[model samples]
Target: MGAYISTFPTGFAGLIPTALQKLLPGAQVVQVYDGLVHYRYGGKPGDLGKVFLFHNTFLVLREFQGPASQMDSMVRSAAGIKSLPPSRGSFRVRYSVKNQFVAVPKERTRQLEGKIAALTHAKVDRVSPDTEYWFLQRSEGVGFFCRLLGRRQATERDLHPGELRPELAYLMASLAKLGRDSVVLDPFAGYGAIPKQVLGYFPYAMVLVSDLDRDRAVDLRASLGGKRGVSVAQRDALTLEGIPGATVDAIITDPPWGYYEEIEDIQVFYRGMFASFRRVLKPRGQVVLLSARKREAEAAAQEMGFPLRQRYDTLVNGKKAAVYLLEVGPAL
Candidate 1:
């Protein structure tokens, strides 16, 4: 087994431990700190790359727990680990302090770079390197020396404004506790991030996604159509126009947060949305929703008789947000 560390968004750190336990069956969760989880796994290291909940997953090369003055020596000692293979082409060093990404001074960065280069016997390419070594210092006496695994590559469909990151979407989808035969729905499926995640990672009997915007709905159909057991539509979320009552097993979506759209009363919007959710959701069926306006969402959901089971206070693109797990049940 190899030791590893994975970074996630700050507010969602608490969820990563349980998420890792669920997603990587054999992995052992060692510890969790702000924005990161350390674990040990015997599975293929590359599989860590496919887990969407982590922002960056790294293989722990060494660890240090002492005064801050010994940081340089710790880095040097970690670089000297004989089991570490030499780098092939190019490599770089990165630094993180207290769960935040920050830039080290050029002189300092270069000094660290020289140590890493000597160990790997590879040239340093600051921009777009073939290898990346990260030094994460959680506090004055705790530091983890690691090598990043499977650096992120940007794609055309990456997160955009008013869109959810695929990692967060995966988390939201997992929160629904779905089964292979579950019938899923995303009534506020803008850009279809949640549905796409469900289709990509989870096995479902059928998926229904809809958007209020005609253009988006067309695009969703064009991209998401022709897939087996998938349906896209242009419909209002408030009514879920054509869907039958109590047919859906789960509703997972990131509804409007009153940013781009004009929502005069947030409670009114949530009430209408939850009312439709209650109608289409089977008894005890779950709803995994992301909302920035949590107070209003909770109030509206309570009034609509949905039982709030769990609420994860997280961040969506630096905005305060909450992911709620609700179930169709008797009025609260």
Candidate 2:
């Protein structure tokens, strides 16, 4: 059976299996090695699982762990030989190790490689092998598993100040139901974390990134670079009158919550955001919002003629955070 491999965030590995089910319907989840899950299926899947070739696998390992010591060890293991040339039919091992823990031992790898070679009578070269014997190491533990092809690395970028974490970005992207062509707009695009993440998955889609502070907007633009087709603007998110009407597909943002300033008019700001969102987003388009004030956000959406579609519980710095998905009202 044609097989493939996938990787996900450390604690969020559970989401990968769910995503794979959606991407490759009826595909058997033959093996799950810690963070890497192996699937036996036919055709290639979509971007939901960062699919990768041999070269891409090498790049991902180098980027994630640097130097690829684990990969080298796997090459010398006897099991490596049994998985010769790394094809879909070959058996391979995949796992994750703690980033700070003891580095993988070369002797252990050599013994594994020798065993595989003896069993299969094949030479092992882990670097360019097609069989994806992958390793993932986080702060907690190591995971090992294998499949026919290695998947791509999860999205990685320089996070902006006051931006949500990478894990949150992944969750937001998935929760937003973003398609390959879905246009994403981030009004309070502080440092452009959400937009950058959206672009990472949907590079060709339109992204409207805006922030009130001009300097922050400039920084966001610089971080985003000029390569991706992104449009940057400096404007007040609360009053999005400057933005064109009926121009957005989905609104996904982490708006400012009154924490330090204890602003008296917090409700007004939320109402404005809701009104602007209703004005710009398409009828079927939705808004996925991350907010500290769940009740306030829900109330604003209701007042603005929007309906709450879904809500997800998230954590920020060990504190409770809520993610809301809303759809525009019929009158809008």
Candidate 3:
């Protein structure tokens, strides 16, 4: 089986391996470069989006030299200038230039595009929503990949600003290991993106979503609720009323990012959230949270006794952020 190349957001490279380990266990995962992973399963892994923000996955036909020799390698690897096909679709060629292929001239880039067109026997349509091909300039060489899945819609969904992205949401859910019959909660379920993605990825898990914004909560409660096993309500994260202590299997939440909620004391806000999560989560249960503000979140987590179990450096809206998985307490 030819390896499939999965691409992710720049800083989210850490999530690729973790998600693949869980979903495609026993499959070989090679981090060929930053933001890229090469893996091959025995059989087709249906719906790769269930794992996380996989920008796209493609079948690698060949790997060879970058820049000066990239075009030659691609042309030859794809069979040295194939004859034109009568009804061939367009191709979106992605040229990834880094250290190896730096200082290239504009003429070289244009030449590479021409080479790609020749290989596909089709036009290089950057605008057309068509078959895609990726070229990465690596230290070893420039790897060429033919797009198999043109569009990976797992992370592309209706979401509000400041709401958690579906890609990140899936990652958070996967970290919790939530599955069939599990009672999972998203305390600050803004616009319900968290629950929506969770349901889409792990349909069997029982999701309890709560949001403070009454209007958004109502809409999400109507739309994001009533899936295979989903419930939604308007509730405050600081006070998870009617929820008993130590009952929740996991709490995966994206708390207010300070800018959207206009929080005066973000530290105090974070501390309250941690305390609430600590109350509802069962012993050894996990709390996965993402925030752009690092210092405040780190301080509050430490003070509230939620030590970090896993951390992924991330980017949100072009700002630095991180995903934290915190353990409840000492394991039984």
| lDDT tens digits, residue span 2-104, model 3 | 4677776655566667767766666678554566777776665464545456666767656565453464455445444354223267775555555233333
Clashes of each: 0, 26, 0
Ranking by lDDT: 1, 3, 2
- Top-down TM-score ranking: 1, 3, 2
Q: Give candidate 1 regions above 4 Å deviation.
A: 13-26, 43-45, 66-83, 101-112, 125-128, 139-141, 155-157
lDDT at residue 35 of model 2 (Cα atoms): 44
Model 3 bad stretches (over 4 Å): 10-33, 41-52, 65-87, 90-94, 99-120, 124-133, 139-142, 145-158, 179-181, 203-205, 330-332
TM-score of each: 0.85, 0.57, 0.78
lDDT of 2: 0.61
What do the candidate models score in CA lDDT, each in turn?
Answer: 0.83, 0.61, 0.71
Q: Model 2: per-residue lDDT, tens digit, 1-332? A: 45454544333344556656654566677555434455666554343343321112221221222333354443343243333332332333445455332445667755665554555555667655535444554432323333323334432344434667655665676677776676778888886767866776543367788888889889877877474657887888767756777878889898887774456777777888888787788877899888878778788888888888887765565567788878898984
- TM-score, candidate 3, is 0.78
Model 3 local distance difference test score = 0.71
Worst 10 residues of 1 by lDDT: 151-160
Residue pairs with colliding backbones in model 3 are none
Superior by lDDT: candidate 2 or candidate 3:
3
Q: TM-score: which candidate is best?
A: 1
